[model samples]
Target: MIQAAAAILKKEITQELRTKYALNTILAFTGATLLLILFTLRAHQMDPTPKSGLVWIIILFASMTGMTRSFVQEAEKKTWAFLQLHANATEVYLGKLIYNFLFLLLLHVFTFFFYLIMMDMAIQSHLYFMSAIIFGAASLASVTTLTSAMIAQADRKGALFSVLCIPLVVPLLLILTRVTRFALIEGAASGALNDLAALVGYCGVTITAGILLFDYIWND
Candidate 1:
């Protein structure tokens, strides 16, 4: 199963390199949105509280632009059927989950870095802020990966994906906002200890459930 997962992961990477569809879409959306926010809202001059919220909002929406591609692309490209046939459900899910996590983790950091540069926000706890980003990314990735699988076969994938995903990630977004506040406003890692724990717990639950349920979802 592990070997199969690795092969799937490698396939994903190679396919992404060949196509660059997801990466390009994410970059375009993220850059354009950041530019709009910087010019229109003057995010750099916004209040600290709102700035933290803005960070997550941008990251989440920007991710939504391309995160669904992992599965949707497979289905569209007619590779999903191949995956379903050659790989067992668990292997496919794990492989997809890993790719999603890695892509999302990088996307979070990229969006955060651009936001910091554009906002000129000072950070006292780089470690804590980065930790929060990691946890937040993982949690969101886990949930979206599962939801993407659920909607991969649907016709109106964009609308249906958003409907299924937004409510599920609300708790994650709230926790992320709290942690960001602590990192950017309170400037204390201690202030966000509980939120960080919550993020970890959420990630564990979602990933575990995803692994357990993928076989059923895939086969169904």
Candidate 2:
């Protein structure tokens, strides 16, 4: 099972890196998002308090643009059937989960730098911000993996993925946004630790759910 899963992940990651498509799309999307935010808010007197939830909401949707592509590409190529045939549905899901997580992780890191630069948001503490972003990214990954699987076969993949994913991700997004807000207003050490804990718990639960449900999705 481990070997089968590993092989699948390796294949997915190879395709992901070998093609300029996913990375380029994500980068362009992130850039456009950042530009829009900056443009819209530059003339207004914005709250000095960082609205962490708002930030994460943007991140989540931005990340989705790429998540939609992950499995949709396979569906387009008609290669998903080949994957399903070689591996158990569960294994295929695991492989996709791993690949999706890695992709989101990299996006979070890159976006963080751009966010700081463009948003001009002063970090109260880099450590807390880092921890919050990492946890938030993980949550995004887990939720996205399942949603992508759910919509993999849909004709309108993005629309379906968002409808299914956003509501489920609300609690995590709320906590993440609040935490970032606090970090902006109160600084890292002073931010609400409880929210961070919630983010952690949300990630754990979401990932587990994805893992367990993945087989059903793949087989369906």
Candidate 3:
């Protein structure tokens, strides 16, 4: 299972690099978002604290845009059957989750640089923030990948994916945003142990569910 999943992930990563897909789009959108925020806050006195949740909001939307494309190419080709034949359900789910997590993590790193420049926010502990971003984004990415898989089978996959996923992801988004806002506003005062715990728990549960349920969805 592990090997199979790794292979799928490698294939996904190769395709993403070959086509310059998710990362490019995510970076472009992220850049646009930073620009918009900068212009919007130009005349206003921006809060040095976590007063504005703009970063989290931008991340959530940008993540959604990036994640949606993760499965789009496979779905377009109706290649679910071929994937299943190559690997078991667990491998498929894990591979998707792995690639999705890596994809989002890259976006997080790129956006963090932009946030520092645009907001002039001090990320006091670089290592700590990077670690938090990685875990938090991985959690969100896993959930998004599972939801994207579910949507890949639907008729209006993109729209339906958003409708279903947005509501489900609100809690994660809220907690992550609050944590990010607090860190940006209060520095190291923000201890994200709770959020991290919840994210890990959620990832475990969702990955398990995705693995178990994928067969039914794919066969349907």
Candidate 4:
């Protein structure tokens, strides 16, 4: 299982490196969004509440822009059939899950770095903030990965993807925004721990559910 998943991961990384399609799109979208925020509010002293909200908002929208590409590309390129034929349910699901998780994790971190610096906001606790980054990526990846697979089976993947995703992700964005508030304003304050725990639980539940449902999705 591990090896198969690793092979899938390696295949994905290789494809991404070769074409740099997803990476380029994600980078450009993320960078432009960050720059827009920087320019719009660079002068004002933005409070941590809205600042944190904006942080997750940017990540959320930017993530939406690129998250569907994994499965979408496979369909468009007609490699999805080959992938389905070659990989088992678990291998395909796990491989794609890891790829999305890692890809978004790095993107989250990069956004965090530039966002903090560009906004000239001081992070009260790097660890707390990073906790948000890791779990935020995981939560978004978990949802997007599974949704991508489900939508990949449909004709109107683009519209269906957003409809299915936005509802599921709203709660997650709320939790992340709350934690960001705590991280930036109060350090690792007591209240933030609950939100972090919520994130962990959200990841666990989504990933587990994705694994169970994916067999049917992949084989369909």
TM-score for candidate 3: 0.87
Superposed model 2: Cα runs more than 4 Å off: 43-45, 188-191
TM-score of 2: 0.88
Question: How do all models score by TM-score?
Answer: 0.95, 0.88, 0.87, 0.94
Report, for every candidate in turn, its global Cα lDDT versus the true structure. 0.86, 0.76, 0.73, 0.85
**161-188 per-residue lDDT for model 2 (tens digits):** 8898879878877787777776665675
| Ten residues in sequence with the least summed lDDT for candidate 3 | 43-52
Clashing pairs in 3: 50-185
Identify the runs in model 4 with alpha carbons over 4 angstroms from their true place: 41-44
Task: State the lDDT at 49 in candidate 4.
Answer: 72
Record all residue pairs in model 1 with backbone atoms less than 3 Å apart, i.e. clashing.
none
Per-residue accuracy of model 3 over 128-203 as CA lDDT, tens digit each: 4665587677777777877887777569777887897888778776666656654565555546666556666766
List residue ranges in candidate 1 displaced over 4 A: 189-191
Ranked by TM-score from best down, the candidates are: 1, 4, 2, 3
Q: How well does candidate 3 score on lDDT at residue 137?
A: 75
Worst 10 residues of 2 by lDDT: 43-52
